[model samples]
Target: MRFLPFTLFLFSSYSLVKAGTLNKGDSCNIGDNRLQAGTYQFWSECNSQTYCGSSGKCETRGCRKDDFPFGYAPDDKLPEKCPKGQFCPDEEDQCQQIQPVGSDCQLNRDDQCEGPPNFKELADTSGRGLNVNGSVCLNSKCMWANATLGVACIVENTPYTAYGVDGEFIDIVSRGNCQLGLYCDAAQKVCMAEKLFGEACTADKECSSWNCLGSGVCGVSESIPHHFAIWVYIVVGLGIFGGMFGTLFGLYWTHRKQRDEEREKRMQYWREQNAFHQNLLAMRETARASILSLPGNGNSSARSTLYSRDGAFSDDVSAPILPNAAPKVSGLRHYLADDGSSEFDDGLMMQSGKKVDGRF
Candidate 1:
């Protein structure tokens, strides 16, 4: 980010239009009267300058051509340029040029970090900047380490601890359900210690040894505490579904609907479709009979039937079709057609072993 000086930087300049001698011959445009030019102050406030700037100031692009005896800006240095954004401090002077600086840094989303130079170790004697180690110093200053980003540094202290502690990194304390001396997810900040209501326990699994008391250090799950939301979610879900099933049939009946009519209509449509299917099956069976030999009455031959299905027909519909090999009466037979007719030996028909001829 662009750093402002926090204050204005002022400077003095020697350039201002003085009422010195206008030192040349002057004349009146009308009539032949010649006027001698000695020194002239601004004849009026309207007598602005020897130059007319682009902004019409008394500088830069000088006077009009009509004002000059010969032409405008006769001298090569008749004008002075200003900084792009700024104008002159006064009409007689040149403008100062200044470079632009942005107000903020470009965002760097590397999940990495950035910063100004830091002080690694402050001097005890002299109150100056820093004394860094080999791993420090970028442009003569230290850099702070980001533990989260795994940024390393040749520091004099352990990470994640108060600067100058014991030889150990950090003293152990269970943040949640993790042990201090054991492994814990540092990101989660939880430890595997027994967070008991009364006293600190040796371990989480020692609840039974502590007599499973309400006040002693014990495992969270001798009867573990649940997240408030887990119980809320379960209860809310149960209530919603239970209320759906256990309706008094009042609000549910008045506002909610049975959908039984739609159900029945779908079922009737299915039945009509099934009947149409059965007719198709009978036709298929008749076609099969034309090409294939028929099973005899006494000399029975076991046969299998393939059931009819509407959609992707993946049903393993193979089943024995016959009444007697001792009349095993294998099952309701299927003819390869989209009908509800069960294929049987006599023809495709059966209702609890009673014959009723209809299209499937």
Candidate 2:
């Protein structure tokens, strides 16, 4: 018996989940006060082909695109276009009859107004059959095309509001209520001709040139001349190329200068090393010459006696004494001459070639 209650709850949840959207003539409620002015609400239970009417029931919508341009209704079920004598009102599910000239109307609802019956027949033969009738909603009233060029006109500055399918604010767009090929000048409050290039303008639509620059002047069209655009591209390309070339040239020059400076330093170092080596070679050559000029074949007894007596070469001795040359000196002639004693004796002995003590 307790499980019966649980089963009933499950069945109720399944039925709610399986329920489909409300069709025409089905009861629906959006849970809000929709009768209040400026209040809009969508009944989510109603299907796309119908809307919850004031009677609190889903009803067939008269128009789709004009009422719900943001896809609030089904495309296949709704009429493709509004009927000729009627127009769709914003946020309304029914099409209302077009109002006559001078009738009261809402701002920005120009479609609800009707044009002159003989407007097409009165046009010129070339413009006949064309849809050029200027019937617009101005100053909250339906009016015919009466404002001519340079004449006073009503310009609706209020932006048109667009709402989402759920009645959420989506966007707002500003539109002027003016005749064909003309726009209402907001500053002058008059119908004025579209401005040409270089003319002053406050909005883009006021210019025939198709563009209004930020300086409030009518500028040229967006499409630039092919030749002028090509020249601009060429100039930009040349600038980029010149910049890159200059950068690469500067880098190369700096690298070359660094390499040259390094080479010069290396050359200076090698030159100094060469000079040092040459000085060493010259000193070695002078030392070899002094050793080769020394007299050889001296008696060992006399050389030993001389060194033992002097202990070292005398300062007055001018002959260069080479290292390890003592054993090569055979006589005391060179040493005795430099000592300033027995020069004649040494000369006579060298000339006679005779031994004084049987060993010379």
Candidate 3:
């Protein structure tokens, strides 16, 4: 009794490992094969009769020729005898059914025999049953139940699932039934995990975060924070203000320098004008002193001297002539006064045998 539980545990573990590897719609033969890819059904042929069970693997189908004694229940009230090769088995005494396929039962109607046997009653020809949980009657034949997630399935004659079946790869997922964190890969008819940031993507729906960049990739949104924007504006404003201040300062300094240079030029011109005026005044004073120290008086005889060049005066000894007087010439002596005008003097001289005489 204790070994029973251990045996069941080993069987279930083996079943899980087997099911995890096989997907739906795999092609398999009855001999030397386990359950179908997706379902737990089995099939095999026995004595030219193939029998299929929900969980048993077999090669052939239909009833065996040796067990032909069974028959369908009789609908008539008459006591009919068993046919030549068939017998009135006690298990079904209601009526004697038809013989095996090749036997001559001489019965013309299908009502003479019972319907085909149930698939579950068949033996496992492959000895590969997994004791699947959900086996049910489908179309009067037993097979595994409908498929679910992670289960292999045949869709439109094609194999698909979490893993593949029948040597086909599962590539795409259909819409409307994908679990959370998974999206339908429609091209391959399979579900795939959602895309993260920077992963290759064609649309925002394929990503988990709902953002897609322009470069055909998934990513975060391109938006700046409010504080960062404010900082940027402040930096630009400060740059503009500094540039304006620098320009104004440069202009002001250049204007001050130009004004100072002009002032110095004007001062030098005034000094030169003042020195020329002083030199002119000193020259006028020196000229006035020299004029004051002259020997002649303003109205003396030197100024009133007149010349008598007549021959009668030249011979007269009574003529008053100043001694040491120069010989007479026809020109006048000039003197300058303080008013800067000229004064002229005219004198006459007579010579009688070396006795010089002058009358002014």
Please report the TM-score between candidate 2 and the true structure.
0.41
- Name the better of 2 and 3 by lDDT: 2
lDDT of 1 by residue, 235-254 (tens): 99999988877776566675
lDDT by residue (244-327, candidate 3, tens digit) is 999999999999999999999999999999998789667655754564355542333332344233332333344456685433
Worst 10 residues of 1 by lDDT: 4-13
Assess the local accuracy of residue 46 in candidate 1 as a C-alpha lDDT between 0 and 100: 17
Worst lDDT window (10 residues) for model 3? 1-10
- Per-residue lDDT over 268-354 for candidate 2, one digit per residue giving the tens place of the 0 to 100 score: 999999999899767755754564455653333334333333244323444555575644333544543454543123311233344
RMSD of candidate 3 to true structure, Å: 33.4
User: lDDT per model, in order?
Assistant: 0.31, 0.55, 0.38
**Number of the top candidate by TM-score?**
2
Task: Score candidate 3 by lDDT.
Answer: 0.38
Give candidate 2 regions above 4 Å deviation.
1-48, 66-76, 117-132, 160-178, 221-360
Error of 3 at 268 (Å): 1.3
